[model samples]
Target: MAKPWFRVKRFGYGAGLPCAWQGWVVLAAHLALLIAASALLTGRPLPLSIVVITSTLGVVWIAWKTSDAPWRWRDGGED
Candidate 1:
């Protein structure tokens, strides 16, 4: 078993939202942000958009961390 902090069920909601289902909503939001950012960045050359690159990196990191955490499906969605 993994620590609660390392669990995917614990990844989605925090501070403001506490429900496990909220996590899925948050995850989807992040995915959408990533897609939008990527589309915007594609219009410009890499060298001209450091901000987009940084933002994309941050988004990727969040997405990666969320997915990396073990989703405790056995818990039926609870952490």
Candidate 2:
């Protein structure tokens, strides 16, 4: 299998910072999308909301799929 782009957080219940260039690219793209959407969809509340929500879910999905391990509560202990 391919190496994961994100690593599980050591003290939380989710993925942490990017562990690969691909992950960084994904994060940057997501941010750019949100910014562009907000700027372009201003004054259109419905469309803005849709774009934000969809983009958020899409990013979460990508992180989960590319994470080094499944997300779960962590106490900073060795697995």
User: What lDDT score goes with residue 71 in model 2?
Assistant: 96
Compared with the true structure, all predictions reach lDDT values of 0.47, 0.92
State every prediction's TM-score relative to the real structure.
Answer: 0.35, 0.94
Output the number of the lDDT-best candidate: 2
> Candidate 1, residues 1-79: lDDT per residue as tens digits?
1212123333343222223453455556656865776687676766436655665576445444545343333434544
lDDT of 2 at 7: 94
What is the alpha-carbon lDDT of model 1 when measured against the actual structure?
Answer: 0.47
Per-residue lDDT of 1-79 in model 2, one digit per residue for the tens?
A: 4899999999979999999999999999999998999899889999999998998899889999999998999999998
Q: How many clashes does each candidate structure show, in the order listed?
A: 1, 0
Structure candidate 2, residue pairs in collision: none
Scored by lDDT, model 2 comes in at 0.92
Please give the RMSD of candidate 1 to the true structure.
Answer: 8.8
Off by over 4 Å in 2: none
